[model samples]
Target: MSLFWKESDERGHPSLGTVMRGVVLLAFLLGGWLPSSWANQVWEFVDGEGVTHIGNVPPSAATRGVIWLSRVPPASVVKGKDRGPSALQFPGYDDVKQHLEAAAVAQSLDPAFVIAVAAAESAFNVKAVSRKGALGLMQVMPATAERYGVAARPSSDGEHAAMEPKVNAQIGTRYLADLLRMFDGDKELALAAYNAGEGAVIKYGRRIPPYPETQQYVEKVMRFYRGLLR
Candidate 1:
């Protein structure tokens, strides 16, 4: 039998709890007979359907699997130490770019606009979590997650979900597209609405909200978008 575990589904967007449980179960199964050194090398993947598989290799959904495996350090290590705090890196740059381009084109939005939003939302920090519990690189809130058909209770740390960079970018870009549509494609108004709710922008007659943070946030993202284009 192949040492690797395979889930029924091809997509690997499994629930966090499911993945954690799978990891534990795999440890138990292999721990009994395997050498300590061998046990340390076990790996697992949870499918989109929340089924967990244990193995030496990941399923096909893990196209760039070996890279992730190699990069994974001890759980005790902190991430992003080499890169400065503000400069976060995307795990799958090509995947993120592909999805962002598609979403922007479909929504008639400037691709830089979507990228800028992602930058501001989480500084491209896939593991970013807002104090209010927003999760992933997009910092998607729970209600927003439900609306987007994402998991209602995504992992609080966002590490696992964020690692699936394409998914996070797609959700974030789509939400921005919706805001743009709602604001009649006025990028500034849409950005303001994104930072400070559509209702708030509407109430303010499409002006940036009075909230200082929201106002600054809108301006900052737009400035960054402009810079990216230049």
Candidate 2:
């Protein structure tokens, strides 16, 4: 009844892992039915022994519990990337407030929007980490970081560049500016695209995505932005 043929544990036959790898290779060669994004087409599932597999094919391990693909966009490729901050530093809201304001000014946006986003995203927490792997005050995703030229600090003690307040504010503000421009200065649509994905916005006819989380996120951020105005 298994989606994948089982391997005998006692006899040590080729494992379900091995079988799935072969199938994945074949699928790679065929390339027609598989999701063709460079985002790894990753499917994660835990095996009976609690071993996790992230690859193109799902094995019998999927029966244990949940299995799903992480459709995060592939990191944009660039040749000869510039070096990130060689020496990283951590600063709190008070110390970094001026930088945030400067970044917003450079982007020709209201400082309140940046402050509100940072507040809504991480409550100004310097070390915040999202379940979806977003890091720092702006909760920048790796793909989004890559798009906005944010990088991990070279000397960080396990902290990403996005977790560094100054860097995150700068890059995140630039990203918001780009989104606003893309949506033709529509704050609602831009915020929606920021919460969901630009592709999702386009898919939904240039409106907010249908997901409840994103809808609420837009509203919450707007509320925060408004409160900052007063």
Candidate 3:
């Protein structure tokens, strides 16, 4: 049986608190366990019947839109002691924000999602390099950069062209957009492919790989993306 409640044809309605608890219970059943992070926020999405579902975890496929419920309050409410901080911000973000935005627009992807990946991958550091040789702001690998038509330029300092903010952002966003398409717009699966390679995702039945690093990478990027949407 479906764990969620369908709206009644009559006027009867459950309390909001009851509805929320039901969603949390559903989350537990679906995930087999609830992470502590799930307690900090919840999301809402509407079903085909126009019944809204609220839960800590979004469905793998959201035909409608997912709405984040934990955004910071309006400016008028800032004087309150319980005020929450604004969306996620990274150091040096302003320097490369334009590049990320442009790349996202070109790829028909969410600017916030692109920025979140950059934040989680390199904290907006254009010179950042991973031990595995992922390069630049988005930590894109050399081969992936080439596939997107971004070539490494010969330099005396040995800095690849991918280290340039604009080139890196463009290549990274394109690669991510391709992944999203490949995975049928499933953000988690696309992100898994980003972290662990598309081969790994396909090998695992198009699910996020079992690798802890890839799992954590997806969670971190999603957290940043949600915060940015807030």
The root-mean-square deviation over C-alpha atoms between each candidate and the true structure, in angstroms, is 15.1, 18.2, 16.3
lDDT of 2 by residue, 1-230 (tens): 21222221111111122223212223332222344544244343335453434453433332433333222121222364322210111124576577678889999999988876665455555566654576666667777788777666676487776777777788878888999999999998887777776778999999998775576557656755655554
Local distance difference test values of all predictions, in order: 0.52, 0.56, 0.64
lDDT score, residue 118, model 1? 71
lDDT of 1 at 15: 22
Residue 16 of model 2 has an lDDT of 21
lDDT score, candidate 1, position 130: 49
Give candidate 3 misplaced runs (Cα > 4 Å): 1-87
Residue 9 of model 1, lDDT score:
12
What C-alpha root-mean-square deviation, in Å, does candidate 1 show against the real structure?
Answer: 15.1
lDDT digits (tens) for residues 79-170 of candidate 1: 63221111113233343567667767776778777877776565455555544556665666656666777664356643544335666666
lDDT of 1: 0.52
Instruction: Provide the clash count, candidate 2.
Output: 0
TM-score, predicted candidate 3 vs. hidden true structure:
0.63
- Weakest lDDT window of 10 consecutive positions for candidate 3: 7-16
Ranking by lDDT: 3, 2, 1
- Candidate 1 residues lying further than 4 Å off, grouped into runs, are 1-95, 153-163
